[model samples]
Target: MSITFEKLSYTYQTGTPFEHHALQDISLTIADHSYTAIIGHTGSGKSTLLQHLNGLLKPTSGKLVVNGQMIDTKTKNKQLGDLRHEVGFVFQFPEAQLFEETVLKDISFGPKNLGKSETEALEIARQKAKLVNLPDDVLEKSPFELSGGQMRRVAIAGILAMQPNILVLDEPTAGLDPKGRIEMMEMFKQLYEKEKLTIILVTHNMNDVANYADNVIVLEQGRLLRQGVPTEIFSNPEWLNKHHLGLPQTTAFALKLQERGINLQELPLTEKKLAQKLAALLQREVK
Candidate 1:
């Protein structure tokens, strides 16, 4: 499934004293099975845009299409729920939403709500629990009894149980340690490749965009500032700096080396590539 936003604008509390414009004339297309990252600072429309993906918010003045459903002011509320089933939305700190007595029940909630039989839901629950690398024993335990990281996995399992074609993650790795964050991102990448799942990630972490996303969208003050591949967007240090953004650590390091008169042909986005380039330069100097 794909998504297209056409001159989309959203206003909260329209016609009220507290009206705030969240998005303004945003236009973009997200192709099926692609990994796209949305980047912006606080209050820059990232959160508002994510809500529009699953029909949680209606466009106030323009058209937005998801899969095949068109959304605008005229879109009926009843038709929106089906889109939620197709898009697995993992909000920031999703573990806080877990409330069922057992982890199995919590994971099974989405599928069961979608009208799956109890047996069917249980089967999916088990499968997704394994998919997220949760231990089989955890199913019988209370989700509240697990560690924070384990609780996170359980929340993710709930979304996977619905078998969404598109996984929209909003800061999915907010409060984890460095190791936990790396592992979580790797798991998402695996799912994107193995299941052909379309991933739309909203994050401030430039490293995530550099290492994973094929494309990036820049939102500034409720407007679309730029949209391009990471190399194109992050390569212009001046522009990123002007917008209060920075490149991934590897890319930034390469840029610094270039400024110091090193001859790195291109910026590297990952640690391994950066190490390899530095090693090759040293070897050539020795020879």
Candidate 2:
């Protein structure tokens, strides 16, 4: 399903004395089955925008159509139930939300809440748990008894059990080590490719953005700064630096090589590509 934001704006604590504008006249379309990344510094409304994907937060001024559901200030809470099921959100440290006595119960919670029979929900949870690589023995164990990373997998499995078409992730890998981070990202990539899930990820990691996202959205102080593919968005190191944003690791390294007079036709985003280009240059020089 596609999402279209039309002149969307949102305000926090809308009335009274402490109102703050979090989004302003944002217009964009997220294509079906695409991986899109939202990037910006803190307080840039990235989290605020994620809430609107499933009507958790209604637009204050304009309207957004998410999977055919129109959301505005006037849209009733009752109207959002189905949309909520279609757009599953995994907040930062999602493991903190786990509360059931057993991993099976926690993972089956969403499906059960959606009115699935206990047997059906448990079956769905079992499938999702395996999909996340959780061992069968983990199902009967308390989620709290598992390691932090395993707990996170159970939380994500809960969302997957709902079978959301659009999976929204907010800093999903915030506190993991380098190895853990890569594993988490690769799992999401598999879901995107194999399950055809449309993913919207909010993260500060430029490497993740370059490696995974097909498209990028830049938000600045609650306004749209730019929206484009990874190449277009990361093309201008100077522009990104001006906004106090960093480039992918390979892109940064390539810029340093350029300063030393290396002729790269274009900057490479991934480590493998950058290594191949440098290797080819060395082979030509030796010949």
Candidate 3:
């Protein structure tokens, strides 16, 4: 499902002295089955823009259309509930939402809340658990007893059990080690390929964006600074740096090579691609 935002704007504490505009005339379109990363510094309105995608927050002005439904203050609560089912949101540190006594119960919560039978919910939970790499034995254990990474998988499984078409993650890899982070990202990539899921991840990791996201949206102080493919966004390091963002390490290395009189016209964002380009350059120079 696609989402379209048209001149959307939202203000916190509207009509009060503490009023703050979180998004200003934001307009963008997220196509179906695409992996999009929204990157920004803290308080740059990245989270605010995401909240509007599933009708979690109504736009104070302008329009938001998700899967062809226009979202506004007058939209019925029932419609909002439907939208939530289609767009599953996994909050930062999703493990904190694990409150049920057991992992099975915790992961089934979403489907159960939506009126699924006990047996059906459990089956769905099992499938989701497998999707998130949760072991069968973990189902019977208390969620609070699992490690931080395990808890995160259980929480994500909860959303997957709902079978949403669009997946939105807020800092999905916030506190994980390097290996854990790579595992999570690879899992998401597999899901996107297998299920044709539209994935939108909000993060500060430029490397993650470079490696995984097909499209990158950069936000700065409640405004969209740039939005494009990873190659387009990272190739111009200076432009990104001007907006308080940076290219991936590989892209930076390519930039440094250019600065040292190396004439690599195409910038490389991944280590594998960079290695190939560097090999070609060396071969050409030796001849």
Candidate 4:
């Protein structure tokens, strides 16, 4: 489903001292079945903005419209619950939220909450486990007994079991090793393509944004800094550097080559493409 944030503004601890404005007149639209990444440094309101998407946090002022429903401060609890099911949020280190005695129970929690029978919930959990690449045997084990990465998959499976159309994740790959991070991102990409799920990822990893996100939203100090396709966003290394962000290594290298009169017709976002361009350049020089 599509999401629209119209002149949304939010504040923390309103009507008292220490009231801080988290978001300021933010406006954006996220199309259905599209993958978008929100990138920002700490305290830039990235997390706060994400919370508004699924109704976890209401805008102190303005509107949050998701799937054509307006989630204002007066949105009832029942309506908020429904919104939660429609937009599943996988918070940063979602694995920490797992609490059931067994993986099966944990993953089944969401479906069960939605009134699914035991058999149906278990079936849904199994299907979600497969989606997240969790093994069948892990279902019977205590969630806490599993490794950190396994717990992460199980937590994600729990969200998937709810069958939300829009999956919003906040720093989903944090704490994972390089290989694990890549695997996790690829799994999300596959899930998005196969299930036609709309994904909104909030992360600091420029490389992940380069590899997976169709569009990029850059935030600075609780305001929209930039929003555009990855190529358009990354093309301005100076702008990114000015915001204390950097382009993908491939893009940085291509910029360096461009500076030396090596005009690659297209910017590269992957190491393999950069290597191929460098090889062709060497061949031309040799000739």
Among all candidates shown, the one with the greatest lDDT: 2
Q: Where in model 2 is the C-alpha error above 4 Å?
A: none
Candidate 3 global TM-score: 0.96
**TM-scores of all predicted structures:** 0.96, 0.97, 0.96, 0.94
Report the C-alpha lDDT of model 1 over 1-287, residue by residue, as the tens digit. Answer: 68999999999999999999999999999999999999999999999999988888999989888999888989888988878888899999999999999999999998898899999999999999998999998899999999888999999999999999999999999999999999899999988999899999999899999999998999999999999998898878889899999889889889989999999888888888889999999999999
Pairs clashing within candidate 1: none
- Model 1: worst 10 consecutive residues (lDDT sum): 77-86
Task: Give the TM-score comparing model 4 with the true structure, all chains together.
Answer: 0.94
Candidate 2, lDDT over the whole model = 0.95
Q: Where is the poorest 10-residue window by lDDT in model 4? A: 73-82
Q: Total clashing residue pairs per candidate? A: 0, 0, 0, 0
Q: Which scores higher on lDDT, 1 or 2?
A: 2
Clashing pairs in 4: none
- Residue-level lDDT of model 2, residues 125-242, one tens digit each, is 9999998999999899999999989999999999999999999999999998899899999999999999899999999999999999999999999999999999999889989999
Tell me the spans in candidate 4 whose CA falls farther than 4 Å from its real position: 279-287
Clashes of 3: 0
Name every residue pair that clashes in candidate 3.
none
**Model 4, range 154-233, lDDT digits (tens) per residue?**
99999999999999989999999998998999999998999999999998888888889998888888898889989899
Candidate number with greatest TM-score: 2
